[model samples]
Target: MKVLIIEDEKPAAKRLERLLLSYDDSIEVVAKLDSVKSVIDWFQTGKMLDLVFMDIQLADGLSFEVFDHVSITAPIIFTTAYDEYALKAFKVNSVAYLLKPVDDEDLSDAFAKLNTLKQAPETVNVTAVNSMDQIAAAMQMLTRQYKNRFVVKTGEHIRSIAVDEILFFFSREKATFCTLDQGKNYLLDYTLQQLIDMLDPTKFFQINRRFIISLRSVKDIISYSNSRLKIVLDHFSEQDVIVSRERVNEFKAWLDQ
Candidate 1:
């Protein structure tokens, strides 16, 4: 099988190639390209490829933009760092979606899916243009719905809290809670993972396993031990909030954006 890999990160691209070869030594990687422009240019050359492993976010822009400029027919398996909601969107068109740091088992599963699709004549004949249209429709669906407010029950009365009024969300004792800007905390029914899909990425970020903080909630940032940074939020002094070491780079990139 001839494969083309489009990934911005060099290390991740290399790791994917290693996994592919380990799975099947006869599999040949034709080329590795990064960025939307590079991918478009490569596809225009009319190279013969059996499959493609693509990253959703490239250096220049979203890899979906590549389809706008060129038509691709090879089966694609998307590798992305996006949460499950975004993965659900990609499933509308791609052969399969794999989360980042692609596991060997997941890779095998994706290949199995591809083989099954190839065996079905009706499924194998689906054009790439139709897939592109479905991708656009899925993205529109994802962007149109974002939770604007939450309804909470306080005693016998129920009140709605706007997302702007909340400072942060945290998990303790397997229960979730949200703190307000005015020094009030409320028990929430949704878990931290659930909130990741509901909340907008620009406003809320999961700094660590225990905390998902808003952009306005950051009052101070102090460098902590072992390359981690301490986060200080208003009205939330229950514990020290620290960005985990693994997420440090992504946290910094999010802040810069």
Candidate 2:
């Protein structure tokens, strides 16, 4: 059987390919395409495959954009970390959804279903577009929502702290942390990477390796070397907050906005 892996991360793509190869020597990995541009280029050359393992969000844009530009007849299996698009993904009867870090059991199950369907009569499911629209709507719902914040404990029970009472976020030793204006700290469950993705970028900016400062908490900006800027944050001081040289433009744009 032939398969194609469409993923952005080189390591992730290689990992998936390795897992699939371990499943069966017969499954050929036709290609590993990374960004939207590469995928478009592949299709432009009239490339086709029996099955495709696609990621939802590509580096350039969404994978759904592929259908917008190309006419593909083969089936698709979406491998995503996000669960918001399940409704739309099931529209095509031959379609499947596999979450990331796909295991052998799941890959085996999908392959079993595909083999079964291949032997049966050919059929087309027309509710695909409607389901796709539903999936899109679900994604919109997940874009942003703020819940009432409170203090969470790792070991000891403690009184709750309001979200507004927090001053700055920091990452230490690969784990993210939250600090209140009063100098108390909490180890957060979310990684700084995931937090950056979810945090309202308009209100929170990753000023440096260690901090994501709130716009409301920034007191003033001080000039620093190499066109970087140092920021003074209200109720938060210990480490001098400086914007890295790489992020100087983004910091300026965030301030201007």
Best by lDDT: 1
lDDT of 2: 0.72
- Provide backbone clash counts, one per model: 0, 0
Expressed as tens digits, the lDDT of each residue in 39-119 for candidate 2 is 777878887677888887789876766765665566677777765223333435435677777888888887776666666
Candidate 1 residues lying further than 4 Å off, grouped into runs, are 123-130, 140-257
Provide the overall lDDT of each model, using Cα atoms, as 2-decimal numbers. Answer: 0.85, 0.72
lDDT of 1 at 1: 97
Query: What lDDT score is found at residue 46 in candidate 1?
Result: 89
* Structural similarity to truth (TM-score) of each candidate: 0.59, 0.49
Clashes of 1: 0
Segments of candidate 2 deviating more than 4 angstroms: 84-94, 122-257
